[model samples]
Target: MATATRRSATRTGRTTGRRRRWTAALGAVALLAGTAALAGPAHAMAAASAPVDFATHCVPPPIAGIPPIDGTTTAQITVDNAAPKVGDTVTVTYTVTKPAASNPVDLALPADIMTPTGKVALGGAQTGSVTVTGPKKNPPVPGKGSFPPFSMTGTFKVTAPGSITLAPGDYNIHTSYIMELDTPCTVITPPAPVSETVVATDVPGANERSIQLTTASGKPGDPVTVTGAKFAPLADITVAGRAGAAQTADRTTVKADAAGGFSAQLTVNDKATTGIVAYEGAAWSAEKGAGPAAYTVIDDTPAPPNSQKLNSSVKAGTLSMSQAGDTVALSAVDFGAGGASTGDLNTVTVKDFRGGPAGWSLTGKVTDFTGPGGKIDAGRLGWTPACTTKAGSPSTCVAGSAGVVGSAGATLASTPNGAVTGGEFTVGAKVTLNVPAYTAPGAYSGVLTLTLT
Candidate 1:
């Protein structure tokens, strides 16, 4: 009886083991079916795991004339703040009406983050859209689980890009909705774009230095005022120009005020000619910038050789044989002018109206002589220099006056010629004829000339 019972138990165990193995295989098949239902098509599921194929996923149809979706669903988007400052946080809210019954919908917020020029992904852009899918349900009841009359809020932060600068202007944010997953039935709505203004505050230490002049024109030895701003604080400023008199200082130094402002006076160089000059000022240190002030330096010195004249008394004198070895007054030459005087006999005024203070002298001679009374001997004429006097009278005889006069017709008394001082000089002359006891004598005439050099 024990042996028979044992055989019967073994047969039952064998049958039960086979049944358990079959049940476990059925469960594996069910699990695979559930996974397939949860995921979409095989191709779409694979594509999601790889780098997005922008050609199909990102590209959208032309917005022109596309009919609006005829569903009960409606969407609204709102940003926490329309005008956001750089480096601030932004909150975007998306609200939707009841979604369609057949298709699962995806709410998308594509913050294009465009610039004024409508370029994307630039100018401090914290871009790319955020997608919120329908809520997960155990056995997703056809359209009941995550479909609309729903409100979804998403938050993103905007920060000034380290590589790009965010200009202060309007930046656009766009909103969209994906109606169906990986199907032609998907409807994307482009809502009215929202704009946010980016603003910046003032930064310190960005001021540049500049300078200006009080007047536009000046002359040598003339004073000029210079004003400057935006220089280094408490800096030593040096002003230089070409508008001062000869042997006069033209450069000056002054310390800038606490606010980096300064005003100073400088003279143009005395010898500066008539033209333009770049009057400049700068600080000793390079931290303080340089400023240039344009100035016109004019020549005020007048043209030379104001006035001159020649006078002679020999033209009115009488030549007679009775005056032998006796000296007579020939002529008195005088010079005085109303112009710049060097207070010395340093001028030899010329007929060309040019004069210099090089000290002048007078020379007398008989250039030529001929008349109805016949010509006198050329060797018989001589002259004596008179001392220069304010009263026009001889006070002292000029040096070399004696023995310096000679009978040379070309140049008479040149060696002993009188020196011109203070623009005035004069000379007296005498005539002597070698009258022999038997020589026939008649009236004779001759000419005398005086030159100033």
Candidate 2:
């Protein structure tokens, strides 16, 4: 009998990348059609044994989707031989298809044989385009493994028929192989592909900080001013607002010498009754915010003085007078008194017009008066009377500019307002009136003055 071969295995397949000569192995023919003799004295003897069937399987399914992106081709192998006896060695062989074939799928094993019934069987994996190497004498028949070529077909055969002696139980064989792309694949780059990013741009600001106007509210015959700050010189002014009129520089304008601001004027009647004045369109350069922001033609014409406050002191001997009127109107009229400063006792003739003695006497501690700094000044207006008496001091009542009744021609007094007269009461001014000999007492009156200061 042939002693079991000490070492043996053979695998072969066609390789597309490598031009190696193809090797072929005859796969084990299927089980013998007729049954072999049952194991008895002869059957269980070293010569009595049944041929084993060969099977193939795979792990990490080759066709499955994963890292490979494409499936792999590979396979595991198993063998079955029953009734083997000791003292017999075996050889196994397998064949795998060429990688070039789209479905080149196969694997093979060689130097295979059944082991003695009481001996441990051999098992393992066989993979690669070429035959895989395994334990020297097929160690134990059934074994497991990991392989890559995921999708390939395989078939195998067991040579060394005389190597195995005998066996009682059915002996099995096993081996594994991998599946990988026989034909390499590559990706082609896309032609003319485009990528883009957007960047934003910012816009700068313009001129024009603010705009305001004085007396923007007025009737058609009344006044309206288109005013604001940072207004350029000779700028065009319009009032399409209430009365709606566009006035050019020379015609409807006011300019500054070194001052950068100016004023514009317009008038409106019932046509300008609307409370709103969508007045903008004022242009400027190098100003804050946007240019010419719209402005409401507000009734800047100060509400008629809510109440006029008069500031001054009166002496029984010193007479004085003052007047207050529409400042805007006053500024325009500038009615200086009759040669005398405004509120500067124009015609100091006492009269019932306000208060005086029985009839009215123009003669008092003072007759005519004047002032500086828009203040009323009087020298000849006061009289050193012969009466003396001081409710607050030593008893003495002097006849101060005695209260007297004069003829109608003597009681007349008149001093127009809006005149650059009197002392310089720059900011705010006051006017005063007195009746030397106020007949029936309580002297009161509403006096309007249009003075120029």
| Steric clashes per prediction | 11, 111
Q: Evaluate residue 269 in candidate 1 and report its C-alpha lDDT on the 0 to 100 scale.
A: 69
Among all windows of 10 consecutive residues in model 2, the one with the lowest summed lDDT is 26-35
Task: Give candidate 2 regions above 4 Å deviation.
Answer: 1-204, 233-251, 256-259, 270-453
Report the C-alpha lDDT of model 1 over 74-113, residue by residue, as the tens digit.
3434333233333323333334333332222232222211
Taken over the whole model, the C-alpha lDDT of each candidate is 0.29, 0.21
Q: What is the TM-score of each candidate against the true structure?
A: 0.21, 0.15
lDDT over C-alpha atoms for residue 64 of model 2:
32
Query: Highest TM-score: which candidate?
Result: 1
